[model samples]
Target: MARFICGADRHQVTLLPNRLDDYVSEDNPVRVVDLFVDELDLTALGFASMMPAATGRPGYHPATLLKLYLYGYVNQVTSSRRLEREAGRNVELMWLTGRLAPDFKTIADFRRDNGPAIQAASRQFVVLCRQLGLLAGGVVALDGSRFKAVNTRDRNFTPAAVRRRIEQIEASIARYLAALDTADRQEDEVAHVRKVRIAERLDALRTRMRELQAMESLVEAAPDRQISLTDPDARAMATRGKGTGMVGYNVQAVVDTEHHLIVAHEVTNVGHDRTQLAHMSRQGQVATGHEALSVLADRGYFSGEEIL
Candidate 1:
């Protein structure tokens, strides 16, 4: 309580409460999110649950959820759990959602069940950006990023990884069999317990080997010579770090250089950016509504087939 420009007392109550609108300025981006989503027709955009069913309880309005979704996307708060947390405490979100905080499950379910509608909305946003002269430049840059999937490293298998794992298991089984033989020669209860443990380990290893054998057939049959058990669409992609990789999809984006707004995007299981030149260029042309769009990318995107 030192008198260095003291703040209001913790327990002090004011007769006139501050409004949420007072905290947000006129040019704040949340207003744009509200306006943009308000102008959309949810039913025409393919959003589900636009009309409430007669038998169920009322849910959050599609416009409210859409505003929340757009705010999260524009600010890079894409995780449903994080969005849920922000809705409770963040002033901008409080204003955007009208103080309604949907749970993480509701937010996640909305995203999961509305993929097509989300895509449709995104396309419309790009159109708006173009009409607003935000996408004035005919030049765009192309890039790709690998987004990690739910699949873990151990559950993902390449043909080479499968071979290496089988070899390691074979080695482990040999070592276990030698130890079991040594245990059999011992004339004590401790040795008997050791043999039983060794037997169990061998059984587990054999079972794992059999599972890998079945997986090997699938891996070989795959066009990419790899298989991800948890997320089948994910593929192993090499990152910039040497000998480092992740199981995920490659997201390609064509972004306008002037405003840095993404004009077009596509997600694929392909790992590299080499063959994406022509396709992304065409997409950029379509999105910007310009026939002579120039595309720029790094050396990794250089491919004779794609350029030709």
Candidate 2:
């Protein structure tokens, strides 16, 4: 007989222990991690720590960092802090890193320290594509997009322009300081607030100008890795649209004509696409070992010498 108000019906069924060992096996993203370790030579590539030591424990393996980065890239969680968080929760990341979750600092340091290694890894994928017959004739599309940078727009400066700006800001600051002194002497609170505000604005301008100056110095000192407080190495580039420009790097890719697979790729801190056509075509020739290849790109990539 059914109860008049069926509110008391309850049941507790015993659940079996299902370890992750069964579902998550060798044929997974973890396999990519293992392949990276076995195929690539981290030591030769200038990786900091490749082998585990006696006294000190080994650092996170390149495979782990690679997997972490790959996962982060796929998920658009490029930030190390966000990747660290994802590592703990994402099942795929858990398997890739072998249930280990390194902190954000470790993750970020891995990228900062092993920029060359990561670039090599990306190149290796192209090699793999070629080997798999996925890249027959290496012709690629080249384009660039602006990913957000840590630097503010104000931090950017040209050497000559920045000097003039700094001089002007300093003059303004001096004037504001003098005005503040005069207002204090005359017991004028309203003028004092105005002067203080002006001083604050001047201070901000000075800070930004100083940062720009330092960046200019770095640009002269080390052309590569010169920090752009907004986005280090991110060039001010134009987009593909009719009249759109974006502040970003030029990303190049070599696509195979046969299989349409990318055989080579490079990221450049260049604003114009005119120069990239020949460079990328040369890279495609090298990667494919072909004398000639057909390349199709937008008008932006067109050049007289490049066509030749």
Candidate 3:
């Protein structure tokens, strides 16, 4: 038996109550989130239910949910389910929300219903940074990256993809039909089974072909000649790697060069950065509260129309 340092007894009780604040420090980032949300005029910012309803059961205060969201975002816990779990276990979150744990649906509903208000809150942070001189520089850098959406490649369709799929299906059907023809010329039990299997495959292929034809019509009628079954706004965007692409959204961001702070950002379905330079540059200028600003971007954003 090895002797170890003695530990406190689990049954031991303390005469003094331990305050939740004792677990959090004055400089903790969660404190910043709490203070920021507390100071915001949520009603003016368009957050729903700033006050409890005049009648009926009251809901969780928007401030409480906002604090939880901010804390979760800062900690990279974006999933509502994960946030709910954290609220139950995280000490900082316990203090932030006064130990009131809302379910995942409530958390998700807040985000879904308050998208514009949430965007306003994000802009408010940039405004605060500008007020603090973090965005003093008039120079900014613009860049865009493809973020994979929840949509899978199979769920997305383009005119070219539809054509390729049709061609492949047609080739498969032809091969099965030729095999069936060969089976018809044979005189054996195995030949009959082979013929049946080949016929089944051909039938399945025909059904698939009909589905593809319907999808082709939809793709052709689409404004961008593409459709994503999962995320309608998602698009097929090319990656940096050659011959690689993903079904996703393009996120463009303009950052102040001085403090490396994001001044403006946009989520777009358009896959390329060529047309985003001017728009992002103007947004950066507005975010920094500057009359004029200089913008720098990679060659990918070099477009004659955008520059002129």
Candidate 4:
């Protein structure tokens, strides 16, 4: 009989001591995140509550939270709940935060309130890359992508979409009414019950139809003829596939071709990339600190005025 390598017994105890630092390597990227946050002056970066309130219970240090955030960003664990879970389990995060686990709300609030500081921190990294000669080529690539917004398709409607939805609801109401009429002609008890249920459904549909009409009127009156119930700044944008679209924001980024480091980025509600060429090219110039920089983008960014 073949036997596998012997495994340690579940109830066995050993004298060997284990440390968190031993689990992480000398060249781990988490160390970079740790050292970077340590070098930053959080108070000078406009990070509020850098120092604990003298009178109240001491709060977790801003550096600890910042380290957790940076580590999470590098590891693609951006969700607050996910970060909270990782604090208890992930060795890298545990070591980075010194086994300190702030709750998810605390983590989320830090990100929400420190938007400007976070942006500055990202720019600082770009500066570091420049100092390292990563941006020496001075040629960058610009592109745009659609990122899904919190708003769902059902919650976003254009004037034409609202009219179509109203039409669909009216058709549904007509079908339900026809079924009710058929049941009325049957005279059976089951048909009678079905007729009553259909009547209720018809009434609900009429109410919904009225609501849709009201929404349609509002959509028509709006300047853009569109409305997104969840995220006001989100817009409906077309995707690569035919008949495929989403309600989202357009994220544009310019990356240094040499090291592939992002030099500039912007989020806008505009769906098309035509008008973004000049704006993103100018931003790339600023980020690279170059008087002249060549920008390359896909055909989507073709615009004579923007190129000029």
Candidate 5:
């Protein structure tokens, strides 16, 4: 018989032959993630639970969760649930976190509670990048991209959108009323069934109209005359495609064209890019440790007020 490749027996057992570090290659990006997070001062950066509680069960350290968060950022795994799963299964993550797998809620709460601290940590990372000469180009491309928020279009109310919704409800109510009139002119039994259904639909339309009217006041009071029920901080912004719109945040990034790495970024509820030019350029300059930087941007960044 011809020899064929063979596999180890399923029943075969051996001593712990491989260390966690052995599974992670030396040049893996997780090595950088591990090193960077170790150098951060969580307490000074405002992360909570740096010290163990006087009386309670122990919790995961801020640094561990922060490392996991950074790993997700680099790998593009934004969901906490996904991170938890990866920590339990992925070899690189297991090595990075030292085989400790905190649940998804813990991971999520860590991020939620340490927002400002994380921002400070991010600035520190930019400083480190500058030291490494990653920002040596001294020139950056400034642009804004709309990031979709948790809010849905149905839950978001723009002044014009809500007005249209209210008008639609009124139209539906009018049509239902006309149908009810026509139903009344029919035979008694047929009219009774038709009237009952029409009445129910009319009530629904009336209630919807009242709700939209109430939301109109809130939308009007907003700076942009828009209100999102799910995510109040998000705004309705038009995307790149024609007639396409989304209720989301505007993510402004300044990237060094040579390296194609983001030098600095800001998230805002502002929909337009017109006013963010000078502000983002200043951030890039500071991050790169330069007095000023050469900036290139599309016409979207042009603003008369921001120029001066």
Candidate 6:
């Protein structure tokens, strides 16, 4: 007792390993995790390559990556980098993936390579809801929301705004040219005349005009004139219930009348809901296999043609 040892020879550490299996059993927050895994056709879901027959080392299974993604989405952790961290630290994620932590690149690649599959998986959830009698084909609600874009304010331009800018620039160029001509006539020897500055401004304006023209050309070439730096597919649309509205895309979904389960969804650049009724109705019809369906939309979706 008098001679105290500084460190134990074995240096036994009592760190508790994450027991993911036990947590995934009955009464867990994600009880359906097992059911979902068991019912899913992982091979057909485009994750066949995730489980490779490698020699000694185990490869990252696609299920692991998918589960991570699903969990991340459920918790609003959509970033790949954040998901990577969760895999390493979060107990639930550790259990979900069986303690296998895939790198961010791997997680990102899974998402990129399986975008269609992921979308299909979401649809499968809707199909499941339908099967469970959660969705009894009935009246559906329609709504949309706008999300901010990554493009800078200066880079974005409406057709009318662009035309106005071009006109102003042209006017400025004309005035500059007139000033230059007057300066030449008045006397080339006018010592302090800022002809070069005016000419330079005119040249810059011309350059901007060319850039604007190029952007216009791009817009013409695009299927949709709208572009977003962050999500290239995202569009600028208006909000519903209209206080002021936002600059983002209209995300429409068909919710079942009985349990309000979403049967179908679409994203559109069109701001107004007036034009959405027919398109959403058609989509709902296709999703539900119904010839005629009742649609209950907010006043925003009300239109003469829609009623017709």
**Residue 158 of candidate 3: its Cα lDDT?**
95
**Which is the leading candidate under TM-score?**
1
lDDT of each: 0.92, 0.70, 0.92, 0.90, 0.90, 0.73
lDDT of 5 by residue, 88-181 (tens): 9999999999999999999999999999999999989888888888889888999988889999999999888998888888888889999999
lDDT of 6: 0.73
Worst 10 residues of 2 by lDDT: 144-153
Give per-model TM-scores.
0.96, 0.69, 0.89, 0.91, 0.92, 0.70
Residues 98-178, model 1: lDDT tens digits:
899999999999999999998999999999999999998999999998899999888899998899999999999999999
Q: What is the lDDT of residue 291 in candidate 3?
A: 89
Q: In model 4, which regions exceed 4 Å deviation?
A: 1-19, 55-57
Cα lDDT tens digits for candidate 4, 1-308: 25868878989978763788887899999989998888888888888788677797888888898889888888889799999999999988889998999999999999998988888888888888888889999799999988999999899999878888888998998899889879989977999889889989988999998889889888889899899999999999988898689999999999999888888999999989999999999989988998889898999999999999
Whole-structure CA lDDT of model 2: 0.70
Q: List per-candidate RMSD values in Å.
A: 1.5, 6.1, 2.7, 2.3, 2.4, 7.3
lDDT of 6 by residue, 1-308 (tens): 56986765576877554565755556764546545755788878766575587587776777777788888877789889999998899877777777788888988899998888877787778778767767665667767655555544345555554677788888988998898777666655552267777778888989988987876666667776654445565555534465444455667888878776678888776777788888888888766666768888889888998778
Rate residue 10 of model 4 by lDDT.
Answer: 85
Model 2 CA deviation exceeding 4 Å by range? 1-17, 25-36, 137-139, 159-232, 238-247, 257-260
Runs off by more than 4 Å, candidate 6: 1-18, 22-25, 47-59, 137-139, 167-202, 217-234, 238-247, 257-260, 285-293
Candidate 1 versus truth, CA RMSD in Å, comes to 1.5
Predicted structure 1: lDDT: 0.92
lDDT of 2 at 255: 72
- The residue-level lDDT of candidate 1 at 103 comes to 95
Measured with C-alpha atoms, the lDDT of residue 108 in candidate 6 is 89
